[model samples]
Target: MNKVKVLVCGDVEGKFQTLFSRVENINKGHGVFDLLLCVGNFFGDTDEGLEPYRNGKLTVPIPTYILGPCSAVQVALYPHISGCELCPNLTYLGKRGLFTSSSGLKLAYVSGIEAESDTLSHHTFTDKDIESVKNACLRGQTNFRGVDILITSSWPKDIMLGDKGCSVQIEPNGSWLLSWLAAQVKPHYHFSGQEGVYFERAPYRNHSFSGSTPEHATRFIALAKVGNTLKHKWLYAFSLAPIDQMSTTHLYQETTDQTDCPYTGKMLHPSLSMKQVRPSQFFYDMDSLTDEGNQRKKARKDNKQQHKRQPPKFDQESCWFCLASATVEKHLVISVGSESYLALAKGGMVPDHVLILPVGHHQSLSTLPDAVEEEIEKYPLRTSALKKYFKKQHKVPVFFERNYKTSHLQIQTVPIPHNMAGRLKRVFQENAEQDGLQLDELPHHTKLSQVAPPRTPYFYVELPSGDKLYHRVANNFPLQFGREVLASEELLDMADRADWRDCKATKEKETELAKAFRCAFEPFDFTL
Candidate 1:
């Protein structure tokens, strides 16, 4: 088998070890992964740390990509784009987007970069920069209005090195080159699940993982650092391999009797240890319930009444599925209307599928009643069945995918294999924990958005012509505890017509930000 080499590096306090163990489990499950490597940072920057993985104790060679900072494994994995050809942006990594964790709380550390050069200059990427990236990820966001790409271009402000300066120190005793290379060498393993302390499967198949438990903290990994030097700086990379890859192919599924566990059925009890458990409940209170429930109920009732009053006229704009039936054909390409969007289809096939949409906009399945939900679900199946009957008689997959905070209609391309679509769904569902699923439900009322009580209260005034002017509310008004809403129409109260008191301040702030972004993009015409 062609082996997959994963190199991981970052800050010491970050979850490198946990990532290693999880990758190991994935390798065991799929039996196609080889070598595990971890770069230094065991103690982070503290004076009291030791090398965790040392030379000669490793099972195989794996590379590590190093960086100055580290967040949790979920934030780390968020950078990866799947190798599947269906990836919409496989040709290029899109502009860096904000990455928030499942929680509404913005992490204080996450930063996102929008331009290519932004990843290169230390002046642009400071400790504060890293913090911004971490904050974005912690808030369960992947992209912001202006930010689309995420990466580390330069070291912290304390590091002194330049891209051109790196070439001069390539010879012997090149400490600068080694140090700089070391930062770039931190190769993170990007799996679909949470970090674990041990391995149970391979990268080619599903696997279970666990985090470091109190019982395993004392356990140490053997590691050795290799260095390269560039002029005036040190660039280095480290190598670490799992010491136990050969022992069991089944990982946590290993039974006391020493047999490989089946990948499916009763035998597959996720050997995930207790420490890796994540919360899996949805909590809501009366205020939110009242707001959401009433709106959804009203929409549904209106939809039903409209259908009864009309002669069953099909409106493609309201529902994507209806749109597909109205405007699409048997074997053509299809795309949804979500932001950060792309169209998808099978290789060498004509794009002939149309995505189905509801007669009215509904953000998620949870917002729909049982009947509407069922109708929505039928969109995929019906598309697949129709395509099979009229075209190749092949069962194509229907993906139910969407991004958070996007009003753009979610797109769905048809004529793709149902199995592949199913696989994608499984991949998402199975890896939900690792992907930090369900963490963004804090609702805007949370304390995370407490910006020193608004300096000016919002106001409203009526003009002689009966026109109303309103003061802008805070940009980020608390939605619920730990949750917030942007000063956007989605959360507006038209009747109140309150003046957006902070509009001028917010506009000035945005202007300043635009200047900064323009400055960052000055040398290069990124608009091209």
Candidate 2:
């Protein structure tokens, strides 16, 4: 097997002489060390400290990869000579780029610390830096197949506290953005500096990739600053065979056993670990349930003998789709109508699936006033405009309104191929029949507007052809039944994509989707 012996070190802080001596002795003893990896702060604390290496008075003995431009001088000089040899056997990895050594081991790095200043500094990584890494991954330049090694300056956020018994005194010195990117890249080994300990985490598998075969587990190591007061060993070493040379059997044998994390003391599963670090926000509107809301809750609890319960008044603060909530993702809003708006479905069943919702919170479409119903029906006309855009024969819009509980009323629109129109309705009808509920078709305006008492709970499906509507009224209906049918394991076989969590992508992909939909739906926007 092709194997490379690597010597990894923490922030050098201009300890090149000491670092060189250590590498020399270790190479002499082992006779297998091929490369020296420095995790940054390569130059000392002062300008005078870099003089020896700048003047060639000191030299790097082995092929060295420095994850920096940590010093002002190095930073100024990097723009011209990045990716070029800085000195004998020393190569400067650019600010943010991928590198492959002569031995064929691929590594990618992002240099600099997370800083508070707006101006770009020598040791600062910015939002643009994060975007570049994401774009590279999306463009396939970095290839989703895991890098052999990943080098970054600051330790990943929560790394220390994430494992069991790990010290929290270190503070959360790592970047949340970097932690997120690392999850996407799924590097085999992640090396970082700026932390105060020589900590090596047990490997954890990443399931970010979509295929059946699992990606390799990642081993993370954080190095202490070199020449610190305690004189912690500034260097760390590990051996890894070239990915191409490692057989399936050999790779499986090398995998880390899933066990409790040494730092957080939690079970070390990648999905669970990623959840702890994911940057996405999910909001449940507790503030909306004020004293009045509480009284309603108590009243409902007290009125157990009542056959029909009155629904609580709509609170804009608690609605996920309301324009008033700061948590609403404005980017996902394709267009706004006077009363209703079109927005991309989060964790959509397909790329073209969307949600049409009222600007204000309503318990269900059936309870909406007559004027509101007329305006909301136009949502189908807007969705139909996307037929040519999505290259589908027509769009199918489905709405589920449960009056039993408080919820923001919204209609779901999904593009379907012409051929699947019959099967789509049949599947839903069959599923409803299995649950002993009869299907009924209701006209958009008359169904609820003319009812003696408003229908509290109902589901409406407007098929692709647009002539027929499938309606069902029930005391209970499966939640998100529309999405489940479109992403059904038996029909679409995409049940896994039913949940947004399971189909999460990098921020870049989300932005791209939003931008595309916004442009496609612009002409049909009622608010315009």
Candidate 3:
């Protein structure tokens, strides 16, 4: 009742002999697993190996749970798409539904790849299958806690949200319906296959959710195909307590490296049934699209065509960073460029704390074209010249960017005492360690694009020596973490000044400070 041991494998693909032999050895050495769950394409290009199991010539050792057929040859092996005990200790999980074990382990699954058109074969699932699964999961705000495991034959779209250096593009091979289901169900562990590769992302926290506190972090694992030539990992093993029998702490234990949940957009409304939320629905609202563009995209996005993303241009009329914006404070401007600018931060923790930001509505550099991204990268390297500028004043600049729940990119620069320069990184590390946060220093010469790519959430910092530290942010990360660390006793000893609001200055004071900074920086200003 405390917990159940489980074994999971990627596409069995008619390699039953090879897969089970390993399972038998694992049981002998690592203790017996209660059940074996198989995903991806269960049959190989042919089913000659499976004929023995169908005719009782072979027996499955571990109690096995599997899905519907994925190919024409495998279709003859299943009795139907519904549940069935195909052979000794072998069970079919059926096409789609919630499956609960006697040990209280709950599993949800969707069989087969996504359909390309209105035509769906036995190896494909449709919008109706998704609706049926959603309704059967006991969606009573409380009873629908979450499943222990979720299985899918095809990997979900956008599963790469937390990984660095890439974004998952919607392609013919991926399943967006599965992605939507993952967001709604919030399973503890999501297992998928069929792409024939092995990838395991760091544990990620699901949204705080609909009228619920933050759920447990989810672990996603994509296993390789059985007996593949490339020698990828095809098997995974773990133990977990059933939700009903576990205490909150054990169920929700936070991992050191946590990432943003892949699905961050709004979900289908409760009032709208799956009938109302069509599978054809792709990207949600984009405010800038014209009526004609919206209509065309709404119809063809389901086709999975790759269209160039057009992030709305910066609006000087409403952008607070733009000089013409309604909220712009003219007195704080320090330097300007064609594509970037610098300004003194309001309510500064230190009098000279400043901000480096884009001149317009850019959200992430990773999303920009390569030419634009490269151009932006070159601009910051020039600021390294400021080292000599700050050296004259007996101080060094520490820059950090936290892109959590923010649109416009803002890099905050704080100048610490010159003697404290060497202690900067160590102090930040110690602060994070005190709070059980991880501060990973990047390898030497790691490019900015490799730091935090498009659609990923992160906290990044740059030391005076140009070393970079990164934290893959999780749910509820402290809003003023960098500020708090810098304000610690080892550094500034201004712990009480961590919150910027308490350290604000009046308009006249801010204006005077900006003028002074302008005078001091004008001689070495790169833009000037």
Candidate 4:
């Protein structure tokens, strides 16, 4: 089977003695693991806290990988050193890189946290550091098949969303970029520390880059700080096989009917089915309410009624793109400009596909103010800038816009590989003909408002080579014709991710995409 057992530990917090004892006990009881992966905060909480590790007072029992830039002093003293072997068995994993153990276990890591400023710190990792790692993966140096395990300093943001029995507020401490990277990398297992709570999420599947096939479910685990008496577990262990061993036969054959938590080995349904306690019942004693408390409650009720009587601030309550509405996922927003902003498209047709939209609620380009129209016209430049940033040397930008008359204005930018541009028009035409709808080629300067009457819904696809339009007076036309065409060109099944609402991503994924776009678009942002 060629399986490798791995022991994952949370923040050591300088509890070397306790950590050593725990590993020893685990080894004695459960047999030896191939590797020990420590997440972060390996040293104590203060400067000069790594003396024990540096002075050889503590020993790592197994081949241990510790996430690094150990301390400011160590980093400054050894700037050129990627990682140092603290002892025979202990080695730092460096700031951000990939490493493959002798057992053939490939691991990718992003060490440290996002700092508030540029000031260097032992535990600081920035978006650029993440981008470097991403670029390496894209370059195929890290093995595009995907890493066996991914380690990060903090828990991914919004990982708890849609998870039953979870009510904790996810703080912004975790990196959104890492979350997005996880989705792209599709690692089989992901480990994180620094959330102060031990959590293991249900495994979820992501599309593999190799083809349209879905990869095995990726398990995400967040460990609480070591030695935390309550709500914390010091370590976790799991068995993983080599990449080649992860074949369809083995995966399907080994699958069992049991629905147990992958980490805790408990029944998932039972845990998820636990009833939630009401806030009123859990926090208060109704019998103890005094007359003063009663009066306070009545006063609060009156205030709520008074506020409810006031009208809403914005009229576009139903518009998903409107920032004021709850439907707008703030994490998807890339860059905010004076008149318009950029955002990643949910269930995007291609990777890094983005949307440029005006700040105000406008049904169509014709209704946009002069200032907004001028800003919107600069989208072609922005699209070109994105192509350069992504290093799509042989790809050209394709812009698609829809003025469904009743829908808010948005300009979609997708990078189409040069080879696909020639056949893209034919592909769309054939697909439209299949749907019994005729496709019409339009001039680059042609606007939907001029072709169709006001409040008439229309879709347009614009490329540097030419432009195509589909005027729809009837509601039977496919609203997602552009996405469908692109998906078909890429040989992907559009039925899976055609609707954005059906394929909603976690906040972490959205944040990472937005951050990457924001950085790439920063140099080209005219508003800045």
Candidate 5:
């Protein structure tokens, strides 16, 4: 119930008196607001406009945070390259990183604009700037349930994705970097400027969210430059109860204006300049598929077979999920086998959502040693220890695996309420049909080897009815499609809980969870 009041403004353009005067009046009317955020061009064409604050002639009213300057002249005004307080109550958020408030409001920001080249300057942000924000979400040290807010200088392209009634006056010439960043961070709210337009898109569900749509949908707002002659509204105000503090009912309440996500495929996120995109390291790997590359591949598919793409080299030392890696969340590991191990999934979709991983560096189920595959599928109960582990808790196991764009193989097993078993196939089928995909049902108790040969890129789901469904991923497959179906209204109805990154518990809580599972799954632990 920790509610924090926030006020956000568009480009200030160095109109100190006009912006602060309005802010002071609002503070007088509302008495006290927790913080103020300024986005876009904070400085204008002259140093004279900023001199009031430098000379103590103007005050910042509330705790104000601003992105780095937009022009070369403004850059000279900023003394600290790593972010620091310019004066009392005003702080610069630096080049890029995650900023957490005392009230537990997490804000991820990329300052300035998208850099065109590999330049090391604040006027524009490059791939490393955006990647730093992604790397900031590293787990194990602390638990995160997504950021409360995200700030950027420019609106993400197609920011009006789900908003059908988008105004013609406001053309969204935003950044693909911001679009890609928005999809990954999944912040509750996002604010930007730079187009000099005041428009708020209808709350749209982030790519990984489905069931409790309103709880996790991101509200994107772009405020106009302050004191523009056209009289566009450049200020917005809202109150937020941090995600970690809200109760389930309050957080998941459905909103009437929700829309499907606008970001999908490479058209929404065309590749920018980068040395390489390591699809193996990230979960939603789409960098490999450029708009041009996809078209060429499709054209070749019609004429003749396109040569198989050589899989990217797997880097074990930096792998986050590897048990021996320095970055692995060791607290989540439960049971270890010679060939395979059971670990509590980080940011799991459910309390019992777990991962079945090979101890060695196997990239997919097709590449596993025959003996190891046999042990995984044909243990003591003629089933997996994963299946037995969930059954002890009176939940049916729903196992899924993706081989499209990953370096390490992980079989995600999420437990379902016992009664929900019968509804699984129908729901999965309906979702696939909606996506124009047909799920090929394998024969009863079909083995993985029968459906997928060595090094085949496929995604398959094993339902609780002992029935299996498979999808051969040729091109443009949705990364979180399985999660979308499972968390849809017909099945678990946990759309809000679809993304694993939003479901992580505390480290101490995770340790206790592993210990409990290790005890209950002992009988099924063939490793023991």
Candidate 6:
């Protein structure tokens, strides 16, 4: 059970020493780890002086391997500096195809020559993008120990002109590069060039190493002796979507400051905003008493009166998913079906949202069949996926969901959470396992459905009852519900009182549930 750790490096040489120190410190007696995986960028352009380190010839004690594309051709074509091609370590790593050596250590490569083309100068590289790729690779290694060898593609740096048209250049080196480099050289070691600067500038810049200092270099070396990996562990991927698309795993914002934008405010698609509406009021239609507005206005007034009369906005029937106070947002019936309904409601449509509901008066998931349960589970995740899908497939982000009329179950819909990739990847991996396949070696073109066909609806129901019912109805009632064809009344009845319904309601009651259905709901517990 080798506790395999990966060292992710970028174009830095000095950091490798620090990386070794850190690895030695943490892994002192932990013989569980047998291999050190270097994701790439062990030495930078200036470090051609270390050319002798390549080809299983490095002075480092551990058996080492470096895998990467032989950029000799690219390096010759784009030589920003002299002797970069001769860097023994880079040449050695470039030829190994990013795999393990006969002796067992892993070596990988990043196309530094191509990277040189991407950046302003050979001496400077985007440390952040390099780190991002490295971190992701390291995480991939963490999942499986036998994956002692891993390789990552080169990270391209962007050199764009600012608004003022000044030749502003962004560069990262010293500690930032060193830390990242050291991490790659040795899996453990604290490397930070500009701790505050790295974080503060991260949002605005695409590269990581733009802020490194000599002071940080000294700290990097000292930390290396003590084995200190930087505090700001890099995440391989980040969810650009706001709160709804974000999974619980994301960095949570503590303040409700406007700077947090989508992270904290009401759920909205990334593109749409409240500012688009002129002189927008929070509850405009609800205040008007006209024919159309009267119903909405009366609804709001009734909710207000109820708030004044009752202990809280909703004792039992606030939408648990969206956390919408039915008393607040003016409701819009986006779609209505005999068995399910969609509503667009918001407290203050700072960002409008979508809501989905399995109609016909059901409150619990237990009433759903496995298929329905499955679909319900996919709802929020799919919502998140659709956001990414829309961005990828449609070039736009859309919000979707149906409304559950004044019910305890609030199924508010927004974009999916960001962490869904991990879950979906897991599902795909599991399916591959059943088929005796490996996820890592799987081709990118391999379709997900090919791996895990939508889980077949769990059970058959003579009547619309059980968790399977929701799946059946949600899938457009392709199955028979009762003795005859599917009936809306039967589905509603199933929704209200099925084995799964009790389970779902109980789950909802326990946890202050999120709108996304994919999330687990805690069962309500009484303390008194």
* Candidate 1 error regions (>4 Å): 1-151, 156-354, 358-379, 382-395, 401-404, 408-426, 436-528
RMSD of 1: 22.6
Model 5 off-target regions past 4 Å?
1-153, 156-173, 176-222, 225-232, 235-330, 378-385, 489-497, 500-512
- The residue-by-residue lDDT of candidate 2 on 297-355, one tens digit each, is 67777788664556455566755667778658787778776777777776666776677
Runs in model 2 deviating more than 4 A are 47-57, 69-84, 115-118, 134-143, 165-169, 253-528
Q: Report the C-alpha lDDT of model 1 over 437-462, residue by residue, as the tens digit.
A: 32222222332113213222222211
Residues 1-528 of candidate 3 have per-residue lDDT tens digits of 567889999998889999988999999999989999999877776657866887888777789999877665666667665557877888887777677787878798988887765554667776656644554443222345677899999888777876663333324266777877777677889998887888887887876645567688888888888888989899999998877677778778897888877765534222113321122110111112222345546546844666555533456675555555666787888887667677788767787788776766666544555554544453345265355566678888887877654556677778888899898888777666544469899976876567677766677888887788888866535445777678765678664355453355678999999999888878877677
lDDT (Cα atoms) of all candidates against the true structure: 0.25, 0.61, 0.70, 0.62, 0.71, 0.28
Name the top TM-score candidate: 5
Per-residue accuracy of model 5 over 445-525 as CA lDDT, tens digit each = 667777788768888888888788999877656555666667665567654445443344567887887787777777877
lDDT of 1: 0.25
Worst 10-residue lDDT window, candidate 6: 214-223
Instruction: Report each candidate's C-alpha RMSD, comma-separated, in the order given.
Output: 22.6, 12.7, 22.5, 15.1, 11.3, 23.5
For model 6, how does the per-residue alpha-carbon lDDT over 1-528 read when each residue is reduced to its tens digit?
A: 122343433323335555554555545654423334343344434444343444444445343333232234233332333222333223233321223344344433333322233223322333333332233223323222112222332221221112133222444322223223333323212222221122111111111122341111101111111122444332111112211223333423322211211011121111112111111112211111111334555676878777432211323133332223344332344433344444443331112233445543333333444454444444333233323333342222122111111222334332222333223333323433322233343243332233322322221211101111111112211111110111111112111111111122222322222233112111110110
Q: What is the overall TM-score of model 3 with all chains considered together? A: 0.50
Distance from true location, Cα of 255 in model 5, Å: 25
lDDT of 4 by residue, 299-376 (tens): 668778884332122344555676666667777887777778777876575557787788777666656777888777
> By summed lDDT, which 10 consecutive residues of candidate 2 come out lowest?
270-279
Ranking by lDDT: 5, 3, 4, 2, 6, 1
lDDT of 2 at 237: 83
